[model samples]
Target: MTILLYDLVGRDTARPFSPHCWKAAMALAHKGLDISTVPTRFLEVPTVEGGVSKLVPVIRDGEKVVADSFAIALYLDEAYPERPTLFSGDGGKAMARFIERWSQLTIHPYVTTAAIMDLHAMQDEANAAYFRQNREQRFGKRLEEVMAARDAGLGAFRASLEPLRSTLAYQPFIGGQSPLFADYIVFGALQWARIASPFRLLDDSDVVAQWFERCLDLHDGLGRKVAAAAAAAA
Candidate 1:
């Protein structure tokens, strides 16, 4: 049976942009599992799968229901031992934990700022209102004001990726020759940026950007299935 993934989207349901949801999607692909996605929006999250969790990236497999990207990944690895392993082993699991935190801290904030307004634009009226109000309160400023700082934040964001860039210089993927859950953890962040905004997050010359291109080609261009926001508009 194909697992059902509750993937978060905006007005364009074809584009699933949530980083967490991307992680789950990539994990499903990595495990070689057949899956279908239910396009969910911000307002619909509460009602997904009978309100399983406050957040999305929910998956229903057979009689089982799982939420959260990391939890879903763990479930897939355990349930389908015959399939490709997401973490590979206990050591890989620990490494994935670290990478997840690093990506959240070092990458997410900048991407959030850069893409916030565009993301809001992608929402329907009701969702846009909710997004603007909630985010303004969270940042204690208007969305435009928050986005203004993204230009300044870009340098820091690029510099912060030095560790990842250096690692990629030596290996094709964070998982060595092939991608593991660790790769997906970081890939999810960039994929979120790619889908949400037209602003170029990385320079063409940067190894990180090159690595991202390769990732987009994975699983028969799974990431490429959803065009970058700019490309979609063009």
Candidate 2:
């Protein structure tokens, strides 16, 4: 079956900036599944797949429809066991849930907070206002106010990634010899920032940067091609 992935896109459709959407994309890639993507704008997502999901990364695999990146990851893993494993075992699966939560609660906030302005710039006027209003409500402050501490923001964000840095220093990926859903959980956020902003999250000498480069090379350079290709235009 040809899977259809409704991917969240900004003004530039080539830059699918939603970390959640990228997670689904990478999962589908890991499963060796061929997918056709529809570039969806923020305001357009509420009607995706006939309003079944008010989110992007919603996938339709033949007659089955799935929403939420993590749910879709599990679905791909189970449905195509012969392709390759997303999770190594039950323990790995459980570990992935923890990683997902950590990425959401910790890493995602820093990345989004730092790149709020960059994200705002990528949207058209209508979408930008919509984004500003919604995010301001969430942050209880204006976008400029939220991103005012960007200098300190980068330090804090990098510090939050210490555990991952320490781990990657010893192993090539969170999955040791191979990349796993846990790896993708964090990579998705990294890719999000990469696409939405010119801010460099990791230092050139950082071990995490090295690992990130490895991830950039995976699936025939799928992750790198998606966002970095749009960097010039952005």
Indicate which candidate wins on lDDT.
Answer: 1
> Which residue segments of model 2 deviate by more than 4 Å?
227-234
Write candidate 2's Cα lDDT for 1-234 as tens digits.
789999988788888899999889999998889999999888998888789886778999999999999999999988898988999999999999999999999888888877899899888888888899999999999999888877787887788889888998788999889999888888898889888888777898988888888887899999978655234453
Please report the candidate that would top TM-score against the real structure.
1
Error of 1 at 48 (Å): 0.8
Candidate 1: tens digits of C-alpha lDDT, residues 1-234? 999999999989899999999999999999988999999999999999899899999999999999999999999999999998888899999889999999999999999899999999999999899899989999999999999999998898899999999998899999888999999999999999999988999999999999999989999999999998874443
My TM-score estimates for the predictions, one after another, are 0.97, 0.95
The whole-model C-alpha lDDT of candidate 2 against the native structure comes to: 0.87
For model 1 the local lDDT of residue 28 reads 97
